[model samples]
Target: MRPEKIAEANEIDARVAGALYMILADYNGMDMPTTNELKKSLRENGASFNVVKNRMLNRALSEDASALLKGQTAMIYGDGDVVEVAKVIKKFTAAKKKPVIKGGFVEGKSISAEDVVELSKLPSKDVLRAMLLGTLQAPCSQLVGVMNQKVASLVYVLSAVIDKKEQEA
Candidate 1:
């Protein structure tokens, strides 16, 4: 390969390295239109997909990440929520049954295709935050309710005592 071409490939690899997740997929036997559609879908969701030579990809990725690359491979990388990107890919694969995921990594940890699919099924960060907030607030809410009930009971008892004293007088 020419020096300039290698430089360009290295640049692309470096760009992908900054993303939160890197997915390696096999696009073998997939039609051009389908692949283009997948690329467009990924692009719409803040991801870029490129067909990468396995050798070049292997060279670009870390040792652990590179182990996931083999055969005909394409790369998907995005700075957005990795789970959301995984969801998009999962949905696309379910519909098209092409571009099978070989493996991937997130934040330097290798993950299998099944792991990616499971990640896709996870709730978004916001939803998870909401759930945690609700859990944390539950006890406090209950504590307030208990305090209110005790005050109401004390008021009731005092009112009864005052009514009895008035009747005696």
Candidate 2:
């Protein structure tokens, strides 16, 4: 490759490396339309899919990133939710299993292909956040309920006492 082309490729790789997470996969036998559709879907979900030269990716990323470059390697990268990206990849791969996730990096740590699958199984960020909010609010909600019952009981007891006094009079 010419120097200018190499520089442009390096720039692209650098941007991909800056993503929050990356999924390395094999895209050996996928048709162009399928590949384009996958790329489109990924882009819509905030991930950019690229068929990169292994050498270029290695140069742009860490030494460990090179481990996943054995087969026809492609990268899915973005600053969006990693789990969401993994879920998209998981769904796409389920339909056509060519671009199997090999491995990738998340938060600067390398993760195995199995890790990516497990990540896909996890709920999305919003769902997880809502679950946490529910959990945190549970105790507060119970406390409010108990306090309301206490106030109601006090009111009932005071009303009964007043009625008894009236009867005595």
Candidate 3:
């Protein structure tokens, strides 16, 4: 490889290494303006959209990831929320009807295109955390209510006994 090619591969490798997740998509038939808009949207959502040479990308990726690269591939990757990134891509694909999803890598595993769509359908991290919080608090809240009910029952019994004694007297 030429020195410039080697540098490009190294840069791609560094990007891949740092990413928490990556989505590969077909960028065929996308105009420059449309592609720039997609890149901007992804950037705002804390991900990057890069149209790299497939050969260079292959050099950077693991063997499993390399298999997904073919014909005008662009990589979307970030260290932030994977679901959010996937959502952005899904939205863009729906709006423009370009850049069809290929496949992805999440954590350390390669996933199918369907898996990428499924990931986009998932709730954001904040929403998922809120759901988990609600689940945890449910039991505690119920326990508190049950304890309060027992105390109230005891108090009611005590009050009734006092009234009965007073009426008898």
Q: What lDDT score is found at residue 97 in candidate 1?
A: 92
TM-score of each: 0.85, 0.91, 0.92
Tell me the tens digit of each residue's lDDT in model 1 across 86-153: 88899999999988998887887788989988989999778889999999999999999999999999
Maximum-lDDT candidate = 3
TM-score, candidate 2, is: 0.91
lDDT of 2 at 14: 80
lDDT of 2 at 89: 91
Residue pairs with colliding backbones in model 3 are none
**Cα lDDT for residue 2, candidate 3:** 95
Q: Which stretches of candidate 1 lie above 4 Å from their native place?
A: 64-67, 165-169
Tens-digit lDDT string for candidate 2 (64-149): 56668897888888899999889989999999886889999888788999999999999999999999999999999999999999
Candidate models: Cα lDDT each: 0.85, 0.88, 0.89
lDDT, candidate 3, 17-134, per-residue tens = 9999888899999999999999998999899999888888777777655668778898999999989888888898899998899998889688899998899899999999999999
- The local distance difference test score of model 2 is 0.88
Output the better candidate (2/3) by lDDT.
3
